[model samples]
Target chain A: MNNKNSGGSEAEDLAKAEMVRLLSIVGRDRSADAFEAIFRFYAPRIRSFMAAKTKDRQAAEELMQETMTAVWNKAGQFDPARGNVSAWIYTIARNVRIDAYRRKRPEFDMNDPAFVADDVAPADQEFQQIQEAQLLRGAMATLPEEQLDVLRRAFFDEASHSTIARDLGVPLGTVKSRIRLAFEKLRSSLEGRL
Target chain B: MNVKHHLSDEFLIEYAAGSLSEGWSLAVASHLALCPECRQRLHAMEGAAGALLDKADESANEDEAWARFKARAADIKVEEVKLEAPKATKQTVVLPEPLRSYVGGDLADLKWRALGRGAYQILIETKDKNTQVRLLRIPAGKPVPEHTHEGRELTLVLAGSFHDGEELFARGDIEEADGDLLHTPKATEGEDCICLAVTEAPLKFSSWIVRLVQPILKI
Candidate 1:
């Protein structure tokens, strides 16, 4: 991560904060103007993301529609304390995509008795919220082209490990190691920031 | 909370991507519940995923897309929508989430059928036809039947620990066994070992008795 394509600057940070603000307005006031800005910015990115995975333009548009609808309806659920707009919107997109093509993902209940909670909040978590996402995005942008390709396939395309390996004409171990390397790079870059 | 053997980043990536099926997702999510280190890793992975989403290439037909979204939004009444805050109050319970719903309650409530040699298992039903998920209880110092996996098998230690080869897997640790590996895992003599094992294919049991009852056992 030494060469973090460190182009992520104050302008980008300000733009991100603006998006978060717009989202809050959408959630709190149901402000049509704010919602319009959000829909304009995120919908295209989500459509492109879904288009790559679904490989069907019409299906992709439909999935994108469903995701935006969730964003409009569940805007209140987006807690800026936990994550930013990109993290929140992508989560909805992934869920919408999975429900359409794959089985529902199992999630652990935070209230379950067998759970360990994050009792202490991350110190200065809110103040650093914008930077935290920036650091991760910068780290990803710096990954080698090959590693980034695999990362996108696994996450955006939702391809199985074996299927990815076959499609790439590489051994299963190769694909696993590529993802491992990409994650390790990301993990270290966000070490103390998270 | 002190887990020795953690799951691979591959699983975490799959979980973050929503690519893993229900059974495998349960195992990974259960581990995250107890391992803060892994949880941090998962959080970072998610943040990185958000980064990718931000830079995704744009889509075409913009005005039409907005028109479509607005048309759909018009159908829902915002006044009727419920905005419920998630329940975040911590509780002192034994079974961690989603797993509890599957187990029907506490970890102590599960009833198991014997697999002889003091090992017992309760098969958990999943809608996924490609994978089989089960809970295994091995008495202290007892060994599970020797077997090889036809596909990948992920065993998450729910309670106690087990010795597989030279590695020791404690609670919150997941053991990933693939078709290439064949080994017997024994419970350490202290407490009965309970684990959730998810397999992509049925186990290739090395014993005739286990083989005879394969269909009845259902993996």
Candidate 2:
């Protein structure tokens, strides 16, 4: 049921909560059954996600395995209270794909000596992370068709903005403005909540 | 006050989706380290991207794939303390992570090479052949080489300030200059300006002296 068009339904919430429990079981007891359940669901999704960005099926398979292995190993890191399972798993898949396909995408280490900490309290940050993903998914269904199309491509396609503009056959300015407008709309919709 | 300049929504979306190459990722990650406002926006962008995963078409799957994965399941090395990496870096007190690893230490650790006219640079090695990432230091009150970029140029002001035409970019401000835009960046008086600059393709140096030295220094 890939009902991305719908807002947060009770069934969707239950499924997400169940996956969170399964992920925690894998994290806690290294349960093969739980891990397989996740693998069956997410592996296909990750493969299709990778297929959109790059056509290398073998590589997608390789990275898909890597993503699952990471889930098995890093499941303990997932916190149900902080965020939903999809956001957490997608973040992992994104990193795995980048490291394998595009080389090392260095990130800001919070443990670094000079790293600046967000002024927001940890409790509040966790609350936002939990609420925002659910809220944004609902908001996304409401985005204008053109804006959503470009935003989806921006997420899935590795192509740069200029390349996107060329393919869309629109002015580069139009592409940029559409993206800006899309994010603005999403931001405005979630203003009081986020 | 927040950093005056920020990465556009386009950059954040690409970066958040894990589509940017190594060099551009470096610029964006380093900027996120200094700018919290962008960090919040990045988190939101990531949430939106995660939502898109729901729409991906599910392909045919084989039990053999699960079998193959199960073959390697025993080797799983669960993280001991969640996402925390080893706190082994001793002198990262100056630069942020991932960049700190690239630099091998903090700000005091950099060994700058002179680039004439009181400017200096250290080219950082990155895997992407299409882009060159470097740390550039322009002395206070000195003008840098005016450049006509053959490709995009991403500059993140790490310390001090630089004026490109009318805009003054201070620490934490990032500027993505591309297309037909030409700039002559002059460091403001009072402090030496140090920044992380990522350039795609070789830039055309306008000053004859700097142009002559450009070949040798490979700026």
Candidate 3:
């Protein structure tokens, strides 16, 4: 039951199917205010993101404008049912930054996987473990109690569905479904930051 | 392509960090919105980002960036934005091949940095969200540390072949590894090996030398 790829294939199917549902939401409207809403939410963050690389605030700000303008022109490309607003915007910013970096450092080859790997450092080395744990606690606050319980078991006990079911006196299917629902809600709430 | 399968922790970390492709990030975000456990991990990762964002030295836009945003919003017409799009008739999550079934679609948000020579690592979102995805590249002859899996690990060969322990996996071959497996994958001669791995825990080094160098290798 605990196998992530175990018997709950149906749940996975449902999740995949659900994305189409969300993307429709994003594609519905492309109004100026809608653009503004998205820009307001992401522009500052995108500016910050670019600033990290350029060290020039004005340049970062200009890049942010260009990035948003691209988003405005390509808003048609977004599918809300497929992803959240934040993910879409963040992806755009990332691409913009990469392109900008490459232009600035033409010697840096974009296609070299070895080059990329050598540049990558371990993920957690930058921040202490304690701070991460603290953020997890904040995110947990948004989850419903039932979903939270299922998540706790999955993460802490590392328990499988069968084991969790046997302990909780529920069907394996129910355990899987609950876990899926909880994870879905959590991911939606924590977009760009997490 | 088991679209039903949950996204691996490593992939999720990358997605959360905004290192995936736009198309893929959309798919993963949709997936995460529906999956709770993954969400919690993502939440933890965000907390890590918050820590970094809080760092006094970290670069950011000016404090008045919000003012500029307000001006932009003011110019936007409210009525036109309220119009909505028609929803698709059927509920479906169709992804590109190989990654369709995988929980997270494609990495969308990684801000890749260049290493010396032909190497690069896109700083994907951190595991805790505080750390970052450091995708590294090695030439054909490069031999990485011989290490063991911290948990269930999935390695997909994206380009050339590399030896994992004694076995060799080429493009499209999915290698599922557990804690017992010790791996020192050397890319085949001629071409570099590009593999996408989703890991829950850190790689465990089998040699003291690798362990000593781990700190320096931190991305």
Candidate 4:
């Protein structure tokens, strides 16, 4: 476990440096080489993420490709001061995934409720966001396994509270309370930083 | 404006995780546009999601995915720059950014149909037959009949204030009601209340007369 943790941290550091380089080149020169590098580094992670949600390999591949395309097109909008590149990319991936899901479901409408316009914050606020991200990472690591399990299922499985409760063999109220407690702890741990 | 009744943490987390249905996401996103506090919280949640993605297991199709990404990257067109409209200065034109895009104009442009008493409503069309979204304008001091939801109802206060038996919901506040709860909401005196409401099913109005007209009203 110790060796695995160290290896994961090392990989994360490398990914961060690559993300910084990719953002700079894309923002300034629109360099294809840098874009390709980013595509190589992040696409696999994104594919797995999408696969988990969509549960279709072909659909996941398509969505992953679209997400990278968005990164290229919207690179100018990426403000390093506002958030790290990974967070920005994650948002793009999430939007792409949501858009894909909307396309599949005829009942979903994208027009009546439009996406929120991105608001630009002051530089200091951006710093706060970065600090808050770091604080949340540390806080997440310390969460009890039970709380983390509920959170993981909620976020990754996209399961409703009732579904989670049934799957875990717990009462509906217990599922809700566990989720609430996990969030409260996250908020409290990162209270002053945000 | 300071928003007091923000979305619950559970709702926000679901939203950030992209697990919410389109109807609920719209309500939450609309509230987010008006409330900066929730927006900040959303960003924090997104950051947390990013960390989780970082630790997610690697996919087996890395090389193939990269190749596919490169082949399509060139065909992707940059989004056209949106032309900014001249800002409207009238206080009556106070729709938030998200709603403004949907309505394509300010509040004055809406064709409000009378819905008995002093209330007016405009039903917004959507692809979701399971959910209904509408704009409600209630006259100051008028009380809506007591009602319970058949499914789920999420209301975002856009103007003025409304108070149910539980609490006061002002501008930028979101009130989520389910089938288990019943309450009568009244617009506070001094100003008419305007809200964007999204409901999964028809509301069960407690008054017999209102219930009788529910089919015609289509609320």
Give the whole-model CA lDDT for all candidates, comma-separated.
0.80, 0.80, 0.48, 0.75
Model 3: residues with Cα > 4 Å off, grouped in runs:
A1-30, A103-194, B1-171, B174-219
Top DockQ prediction, candidate number: 1
DockQ-based class of model 2: medium
What is the fnat score of candidate 4?
0.35
Model 1: CA > 4 A from native: A1-7, A192-194, B59-61, B78-92, B212-216
lDDT of predicted model 1? 0.80
lDDT of 1 by residue, A1-194 (tens): 22344446657667787888988888888887898888888888898889888788899889988999989888866777664788888888999988887576878765555677665566666655556677777777778888888878887888888888999999989998888888888777666454
lDDT of 4 by residue, A1-194 (tens): 11222222444545675687678788677788888777776788888878877899788888888888888888877776654677788878878887877731112122233223335557667666555555666666777789878876776667888889999999989988887887776677667453
DockQ comparisons of all candidates to the true complex: 0.62, 0.55, 0.05, 0.36
Kindly report which residue pairs in candidate 1 clash with one another: A113-B93, A114-B94, A114-B95
Best by TM-score: 1
Better of 2 and 4 by lDDT: 2
Worst 10 residues of 4 chain B by lDDT: B81-90
Write down the lDDT that model 4 would get.
0.75
Question: For model 3 chain A, where is the 10-residue window of minimal lDDT?
Answer: A103-112
Q: What is the per-residue lDDT of model 3 for residues A3-81, given as tens digits with 9 covering 90 to 100?
A: 2212224443344234334333334654554444455545666666667557797898878886776666556565433
Q: Output the lDDT of residue A26, model 4.
A: 85
Give candidate 2's TM-score. 0.89
Give me the displacement of residue B34 in model 4, in angstroms.
1.2
lDDT over C-alpha atoms for residue A52 of model 4: 74
Ranking of predictions according to lDDT: 2, 1, 4, 3
